[model samples]
Target: MTTNPERTIPPTTAGERAMLESWLDFHRETLARKCVGLDDKRLREASAPPSALTLLGLVRHMAEVERHWFRRVLAGEQEAGRIYYDEADKDGDFRVSESDTWEEAHATWQAEIARARENAAGRSLDDLSAGGHRDIESFNLRWIYVHMIEEYARHNGHADLIRERIDGATGF
Candidate 1:
């Protein structure tokens, strides 16, 4: 097992909000850590046939996810040009091109994360999203936090396998 030094485990004991934030941050760092030492070509390598999943793709997808949940849904703001995918190309973020660079993907994901934190700051956990997302309307901040944690946890598992496959690395 290869341990990534970037992430610190969430504290075992904390308040509700603090715990949620910590775990979410940990999972985010976990994903980034998984891709830490890879080249762009390796980051864009698919896991297997028929599945376009890649580390770079996951980073882009997470950037899209973070923007959607925080900026559009929670903050009730338009993300404008930075949106990574759309209905016309639903899998756009997951389809990494030769042009895609790890530098750009990492920066975008990190930027979205910073924006997510900014959008959530000063808001109570009970606060509702400023708008609806898909078939759902009005997600409380707490739910968004939990949902993000779950999303990252699930994707982090994929990242684990991908990283392992890429460079025989595991653990963070």
Candidate 2:
């Protein structure tokens, strides 16, 4: 059965920034809802053979993504570093270990999301990122929001499939 009906629905019409943030928030809630009632082991369950994707891992990965775009790129904190991954094992976030508890991961992800909001607050959509990453130079808040929406939407799809596989739950 579905869960978490409290997710905010994006308005049919709204200002540009409001629309983007709303959609992003909706997708964020969708991902979290996919994991509802699932235990840590279940949350870490892979999709199938040869695929290590998990809901908890997705949460962690998104945490890293939020930190990178907001704090490191937009806020220009080069030394902020990564939360769950590094040079050797870029997919470490997805490599959910036994030590990684769902509660802790969720809290960390939420913290990153909050910081993302704080960093973007009072900033114009046209404002370029204080720094840039490999290949690209900089991205405006608009671009970051759009990219984050896309990222979450794509992962929510994966989350749907994984949640379905776990206990035949679907269409949350």
Candidate 3:
């Protein structure tokens, strides 16, 4: 089994925000580490029939997710359009095409991550969303951080299985 080096979250950390950010970063690297050494074709391969998931698709979907939560909702950019979703096809992020290369997907995901960090920087965990859509008016920065960490954790589990299936690699 091949081993990939991943960023480790400190077992014990100071402050809630620091701990949350550290774990989120670790999970982000974990997903990227899963895709390491895979070519575009391999990254685009699905685990089994009927599921449209792929490492490339997950990367794209995460990019869309980061943009939605950090930029659109938390930062109050309601006019911003989704990075991958479409009214006609809501699952465009997961429905990646042959034309979507791993390079593009990974780069977009990285960019979104950077933007999310920038948006959250200097803001308190107690900071609330500037605005939100109907019904849900606002959310605290802490909620966004926790939600993102949870999202990444769930998706990283999928990534683990997918990576293992791809190359028999396990335990990064």
Global Cα RMSD, each model:
2.3, 1.8, 2.3
Candidate 1 least-lDDT 10 residues: 1-10
How many angstroms is residue 34 displaced in model 2 relative to the true structure, after the best TM-score fit?
0.6
Query: Model 2 over residues 1-172: C-alpha lDDT tens digits?
Result: 1256369799988999899989989988888889888888899899987999998999999999999999999999998899999999999999998778888998999999999999999999999999898989899999999999999999999999999999998987
Residue-by-residue lDDT tens digits, candidate 3, 61-159 = 999999989999889887768888899989999987779898788888999999999999999998999877558989999999999999999999999
What clash count does candidate 1 reach?
0
The per-candidate count of clashes, in order, stands at: 0, 0, 0
| Each prediction's whole-model lDDT (CA) | 0.87, 0.91, 0.88
Residue pairs with clashing backbones, model 3: none
Instruction: Provide the TM-score for each candidate, comma-separated.
Output: 0.93, 0.96, 0.93
List where candidate 1 sits over 4 angstroms from the true fold: 1-5, 79-82
What RMSD does model 2 have?
Answer: 1.8
**Candidate 1 lDDT over residue span 17-80, tens digit each:** 9999999989998888888777889999998777889999999999999988999999988643
Best model per TM-score: 2
Q: Among all windows of ten consecutive residues in candidate 2, which has the lowest summed lDDT?
A: 1-10
